[model samples]
Target: MTVKENFELAKKAYEKWDIDIDHVFAQLKQVPISIHCWQGDDIGGFEVNQSELSGGIEVTGDYPGKATTPEELRQDIEKALSLIPGKHRINLHAIYAETDGIAVERDELEPKHFEKWVQWAKKNGLGLDFNPTLFSHEKASSGLTLSHPDKEIRQFWIDHCIASRKIGEYFGKELGTPCLTNIWIPDGYKDTPSDRLTPRRRLKESLDEIYTVKLDEKFNIDAVESKVFGIGSESYVVGSHEFYYGYALKNDKLCLLDTGHYHPTEMVSNKISSMLLYSEKLALHVSRPVRWDSDHVVTLDDELKELALEIVRNDALNRVIIGLDFFDASINRVAAWTIGTRNMIKALMLGMLMPNEHLKQLQEDGNFTERLALLEEFKTYPFGAIWDYYCETMGVPERENWLNDVKQYEKEVLSHRE
Candidate 1:
């Protein structure tokens, strides 16, 4: 009937399994999904001397009203955040820096370039995350960055990454939350490499150099994201999953896993528990992949739920850093963010509602039939009711009503961008 009444009924259903409905809300509130800023601009950063989008990253569709300026991008992000349920962080790339129309080399960027961003984050009470933009630059024209054979090119990227970490540290110190500075380079060969070891060895050396400039862990945390293959590097990617996995362990860095960066059949959900066993902390770029590394918007699918279940059941919610990663220029950009982020929170909510303890006991007792049955049955539970209540409680639009807000914003704000 009403949001509260429906929530009450749903609460009773979950209570049967001894699930603390209030506790679930408390846990979910603590999770701050880092919403990627690139999505608002389709990865087109605000550099005065902007380069073409390269390095196996592609954003399709010529959607109208794409954010073209720093103020515009931040404004659009604010709009999306209003519709989202919980407090969240903004994930930014180095190219998004503002230099007052002066061309600042990536290697030369400093905290001053992002002073406005820090101020905006402070105003909004949002934590900030950082990424070293390794692609879409002249240095990466050959599709190699950290793993490039040329020592000069490798050093350039290393310098840029070092600068990025310092910026991240700035964000952390100003915002009172540690910033995650992730490094993902598009270094690979399209054709089978005659010698793969040289590139990977160079990459290892370059990483060793970058990590030498260490900031306090309380401010900036470092992460390395690996991709199996990209557009130009279908044959072999230098920073592969196995390579980064081993490197993260040895270096004590976090391995950032992108859901779209795996083989066709490989599931990120399956790897979370295993990675958690070894890594004290890991990061996730939650995006959907279709045929290849498509970087599609995340949906409320089986894999998303399973991924959330792993985090919730293993009690590693705080350990796994969750962030959204996908840019679809085809749809309303603000709506895209709203839908994907809401689904992520929804998946986590569903995971909390599950009888995880009972399910684990069933498996331990060899009760596969009951486990399977309950799992299927819970899929049709009163999940929507609880979700509606959450949105209402969090002071956002309930369900599809958020779409109306997006449409109105498109009319009032985004439509005027052109």
Candidate 2:
């Protein structure tokens, strides 16, 4: 709704209800927001801060058809900022890429090379969001067929993280502000008999080494991008909802939601609802779908998209961190970032956005009402109309573009009045 329209609604509602309607108006102030640089096409290597949005691209992982270089990772983030240059900056929290040596490994980011990334971020103005995968991709290196069983594999990863911390060491200390370190281990299940691995307890212990350090220091929490999957179509540990819920309760750390991870099935909104039940202990994010694929391109999937927003609203939460969760080998970070952002908005359908039961609880917990307003804002989106009746059980926005499309709507209403 426009500023004037919003005020008018409040006036009408307040006259009838006698509620301090303006009490809910969120102060127009900068809120600490973050976006992951998994997509390089539109928003790679760039920092989006309330102050200035510019930074280097952050690319990672070794994919079959994907190709994103350090330069691309550097450029994407830089461009995202330049696209919306202004004061009160929108800082880049960090560069997030996997640990595939083929794309990015500590060795790939040699001392000087690492400095270049940092310097670029500093120059362009952004922070870092490190993923545990940034250290190694033995799985990918081994052709994504064999799992590394050598202690060196795990130890090497630990060492790389320590090194990253040393390199990332900032504020005269090790680590950066709003720093993010993610560890998504054998997060899936095994399919065959020959595939041997450590127990979940030991695996958690291994990841805990780093988690302990940060938690002890009370540093930035490393979000666990949990998923339920298996190798060769076999299920994995963190792949199922049961495992994820168990892990969240046991780990006592933040969990990141990857929308597409539960692809092919599962209600994204329902999952969001469950997670928010444990807010302050978790975070939310999205990645585009690839193929019948575990994680692929992020095109608009009707059921999935509607469900995702409902999940957000159901959880009644805001300040949710969004990122490119696409792990396709064919696409680069820039393409990933752009597609990710576009998908975020395109997921919404227009009409009167309203909070549901889940939102009410979220509001009660968050001590805020922006969740209500956000739903209303979504109503003005162009896509809402077509989807308005798609599933009327839940309220959605009417279809109308905020600009040109809305004008036509206005004329129709005026003509009927005359």
Candidate 3:
């Protein structure tokens, strides 16, 4: 049988449990996954002519064809988006501003700096998201920004964050979509600090100052991201998960959960339901981590599937904002984006295709045996057929066919980059 015939058979099988395959397809197509622009440039922004990475962040391996300019990065992103099957948004870091060959400090950034980006996003029919580049600058070399002891330095970072929120609002107003402005600072100690409370207090005060001006939520939303520890912050990280969770709840802002920002034993999937209970909305930075916070490319792993399942099962698709957050400079950048994004979409589709209501009913009735058996049976369902149908209907290449397009782009576009 052909792919469509197989999909029809699978659809009929799922109908036994009252699952609507067409509804799942319609919902999946409407979900927008924000693709991180840093992936195309290996997290090196266009703010300066730098040779090394800073702010306790590291990108290993010397991959060829890394995007060096804004135009190159956009070109690469267009190619990757062409192969992926969904409407999506682009997540931007503050350091990516096009300054017109003039030196523009972070604190002095204006909406006009990103006018080119706004135009580009409009032309491509993509929405925009923003982040404060709290690291990789001289101000952040001391392993602190908003939490720094020096009032001058802390105020500088606060001003930068405030500027970023304005830029985010501008993007949203221009593109007619709410842009999420996330603040993630790399501030901590290499050794245990006796004055931990001082830094946290400073951070709280700095955040208050940054958020003093309330922007309309229709144009922009604020989010705070946390990290367990970074390279130089192994001993202590001021903005840990608890800190952001409390801050977000108190301030009525969204808390962002980066998948690689936790201990090896902890899974972000388990935290989603709990977070949704307190916060009105939540943001996610999905990435694959091997043992530690190494920003590896995403794949169809068990945790990825579980994360997607939790979102679908809880009916929180509209409340949760999803974005990709990995940078693997060891391979082709365009292919990396295509692979990670396609796998993410695939994982979400798998979760949506599950008989979640039936499983919940079985669990509630204490029919553990049947629930386990049916779940195992679900593993063997023709999910691939439905996925292929999704790609075909969305007008994107199915499965391995996307790789051929990536390879072709590498030869025609990426390989020419010096």
lDDT of each: 0.95, 0.42, 0.91
Please, what are the lDDT tens digits per residue for candidate 3 over residues 200-293? 9989999999999899899999999999987899989999999999999999989999999999889999999998888778999999989888
Over 4 Å off in model 3, which ranges?
49-51
Which segments of candidate 1 are over 4 A away from where they belong? none
TM-score of each: 0.99, 0.58, 0.98
Q: Indicate the residue-level lDDT of 277 in model 2.
A: 68
Per-residue alpha-carbon lDDT of model 2 for 1-418, expressed as tens digits? Answer: 5534444554454334232223222211111224454443222332111111111112335422222455544554554333221211122222333233334444233333345555666665555555533212333342121123455655555555554443334311232455544545433334543432444444455555644444332434455655544343344442244544566577775667766555556656566555666755445555544433245556666644664456444434343444445434354333344344344444532101333444566677994677766556644433332232222212222222212422343344312331
Error of 3 at 273 (Å): 0.9
> lDDT of candidate 1 vs native?
0.95
Give model 3's TM-score versus the native structure: 0.98
The candidate with the higher lDDT, 2 or 3, is 3
Q: Taking the tens digit of each residue's C-alpha lDDT, what string does model 1 give over 294-397?
A: 88888999999999999999999999999989999999999999999999999999999999999999999999999999999998989998999999999999
